[model samples]
Target chain A: MGSNDLQKQAPNIVVWVLLLALPLWLPYVGGYMELGSRVVVLALAAMALNFLLGYTGVLSFGHAAYFGLGAYGAGMTIRYLVPSTGVGLLVGTLVGAVAGAIIGPMIIRLRGVYFAMVTIAFAQVFYFIAFRWNSVTGGDDGLTGWTRLPIHLGFTTIDILHNPVAFYFLVLAVFAVAVGVMAWLLRSPFGRTLIAIRENERRARFLGIPVDQHIWISWTISCAVVSVAGALYALLNNFVDPRALYWTQSGDFVIMAVLGGMRSFWGPLIGAAIFVVLQDYLSSQTENWMSFVGLFFVLVVMFFPRGILGIIRRKVAS
Target chain B: MTQVVLFNVFNGLIVGAFYALMALGLSLIMNLSGVINFAHGGFLAIGGYLAFTLMPYVGFWGGLVLAPILTAVLGLIVERVLVRRLYGRDPLYSLLLTFGLAFMFEDGTRFIWGAQSLPYQVPGWLLSPLSSDYFFLTGYRLFMVVIVALAVAGLFYILNRTRLGMRIRAGTLDLETVSVLGVNVRVLRNMNFGLGIYLAGLAGVLAVGQLGLQPTIGSSLIMPSFVAIIVGGLGSLPGTLLGGLLIGVASGVTTVFFPSATEAVMYVMMAAVLLVRPRGLLGEEGRF
Candidate 1:
């Protein structure tokens, strides 16, 4: 609040403190540690989705492909890769990255509704492959017993297996790192190219930028981030199922990003937090909660079409 | 093998009829308004529920006709108040805006109807059994085939023979030009949207017993209807018929042969269609 504190600290540092302290406090006192962690994970996924959809003007209805892939990868790798949570996460991220690279070229060629439909189909195929692949996926029961990150401070090794406190920190730490990376990405020269691509691909092409390649990379990065969320989600639930990768789950993340406002670095985190909390609150109240949610979604699109962040931006601009 | 084939064929034909009904309406609205009415299915659901609600008072036939007419009235209102403002804006906004409307309408129906499945029964006259030497079929299915055939023929005649049809066709090609030429394009657009929605409503009413009515039920049907639109070759009636038959058969065959892969069949088919023929099996180039 004072010039002395402003001189002593940077804005980003204060933001990090706020992000970390909330998880720490929520776990220790508020006692909604699990719900908070879940929100954080969803926020991370929603943020990644917003990059391509909201920021880049691409709408993908099949993002669950990466999410499901990441979860399944993490779950399976942990079953064999053993004891190291970080390695399992790496395994999932890399697997998702590889998958994204392969699917990226095929999907990027489409536009508007066609693109949306293709993504939806791809997600369904991903679900079917997971669902029907009984031998590897364990046929819907999902591979379980995923090991959490074992934190070793050289002389002290803290087993994070099923520890809510440890898991919260894992999610929080990754989220913080992702936010920093995403912020940097947004500010980078390459990010400017992405904006160019979004505004007009033909013009961006005429300007000598490799627009398709840029879109592909953005999509790859987007899917990679979602995969990481999927990994953490698998860890949180201690189970992996094809349901995670279902088309509906993909829609859920899209809804979150749109609700929070598609424009900013902060929109998805706020959106995800609000969405998860709202659903829990609303679903508890009525059997027709979905109807209410659908109505809420309509109102959001019609009234707050640019999103809450967009609202904030307008007010600030004015 | 013959029996299975026959069943698949029958199933395909019947399902194709439903697809044509919905796709016809969707294509009409797109043609006239230049907006892809995403809420078409919502209107369909409303029409179905309206009929379901009216069953106590008017019986089956009354519900069928009245439900769609009521839905068309709602469509008329939507076009006037909300959708008309979106004219000449980006088609994307219309898409998003209509999606929002769809969400609202779906939820509103759920709130009014309650969140449970409702059953639709075939009336006494339509309940008679159909006996054939080669195949055994429900008289209701045969009745559906005949009714849908008549609806399609009636729609075709109206579009070709009527002055209102000429206005809509002219409007679809270019609304601004039509407006400049002294046609009431706004009124045409409103009536076109209402007409499109009425078809969805009728299909919804038809779907009562087959798929039943639920809040989220129409959501699932949206994809298939879209598929029908795609297959039929955007804004073409004949193309839609051929497309619907192809899709229905493809799905029925795939479902019969591989139950697990059944759900994704339509999507897979759509992708294949796009790659091989972007305008659909019956669509012309530059349509997309």
Candidate 2:
């Protein structure tokens, strides 16, 4: 990230301490932190999307396809070939990037609803492949009976997944580092190009920016980053379903993106937290919980067009 | 083989009528306002539930008529308050706004009607029109086809010939010019939005006799509506009908042969269409 951005982040570095320390207090906090861990991972993914969408005007409706694919890559790897979390992660990201590359060529041709529709279509295609290609992907029931790696340095073994605290710390570390990278990217000249692309593609094209390529690269990296969240979600949930790859999953991601206020990275994080909390709270109370949730969505989209965090930040800045 | 083909073709036409009923309003709205009414299916779902509620008093026929009326009124309010604000905003805002409205309407109906699919019976006249050894067809579907055909013809006549049709065409071509010509643009817009929504509601009413109305049907229907529009070409009325018919027939035929591929059929069709013609089968340049 740029020096100015780094300086700006310095004041918020206490958040890093809190996130890292959550694992230490996990023995006390327990289930809450586990959910918190999942939320943070999703938030990180949404943050990446906000970078592409809010900053660059590229709204990806099929992002969950990449996410589910990455999760499948990790889970499938552990189930069959390699068992290292790090390698699984690398492999998952590679699969995501590869998928993004394949999808990217046609995506730049669409903008607005057309682009969104194409993403939805691609996500559905991926989901169908995952479902219909039953022998390889395990189909509807999903690939289960997989194992998580035990952390060891060739001397002693500690089952990382067994200890929620260790897993929490791992997620926090990864999330923080990813966010840091995103912060840096946003401050770079390339980030300016993304912003310029978002504001006016015609102008950027006039200014000699490889506009389509910029969109292509931004979308690809966005998918790659979001894939990390997918992998983590699978690891956290201990299972993956075609549902994870469904267009509805993409809808949820869009909801979180809009709810968090897409203007900033932290907005998505906060939005993700609120979304998870509300989901848990509402579902626990009533089966008709979607009604409340739907109303909440309507109110948010209508009254607070900038989203919850956007309103708060506006107030603070003013 | 002929029987199977004929059966599938008849089935496709029956279902195509429903698709036409669902998509025609969306095409009309997109024509008048430069906005895509993503909530089209949600209104359909509302009509289904509203029909379900009116079953005891209105009977199926009366309920069918009432649903569209109520929905059109709802459409007017929505256009006046919500959609009008988005006149000059980015199309994304319209997409998201309509999406949000769809969610609210669907879930609100669910809150009142519950999430379970409500049971519905076809009216007596249409319930037992035909039963045969090789083929059995629900008379209600045929009835829906006839009803939708009438609606389509009526809409086509109005849009192509009426005095109001000229204004709508003018507005679609350039709303600013129509406004400058001293037309009551706001009233026309509200009427247009209401008219479009009425069609969606009417489609929903007709649909209840064929399929049970559930909480999530709106989400299910939205994609196909999109596929129809995309294939037919956005904002093109005739295109919407053709697109709807092609998709309905194709997907229905595919389902008979390959049941498992039914869900992915629309996307497959869309992809193939894009490969052959990126502007859709009937889409013109600069429509987006």
**Top candidate (lDDT):** 2
Instruction: Report residue B229 deviation for candidate 1 (angstroms).
Output: 3.2
Q: How much lDDT does each candidate structure score?
A: 0.77, 0.79
Report the lDDT tens digits of candidate 2 across residue range A72-100: 98888887888788777778778887898
lDDT of 1 by residue, B221-271 (tens): 666767777656676767876766677777777767886776567767766
Q: Write the per-residue lDDT of candidate 2 for residues B192-255, one digit (tens) a residue.
A: 8888888888888888777677877777776677778777877678888998888888877877
Q: Could you give the DockQ of candidate 2?
A: 0.44
Best by TM-score: 2
TM-score of chain B of 1: 0.94
* Angstrom error at residue A312, model 1: 2.3
C-alpha lDDT of residue B190 in model 1: 87
Cα error of candidate 2 at position B141, Å: 2.3
Q: Which stretches of candidate 1 lie over 4 Å from their true place?
A: A1-14, A24-31, A76-84, A94-99, A127-158, A240-243, A246-248, B30-38, B81-116, B124-129, B132-135, B158-163, B231-238
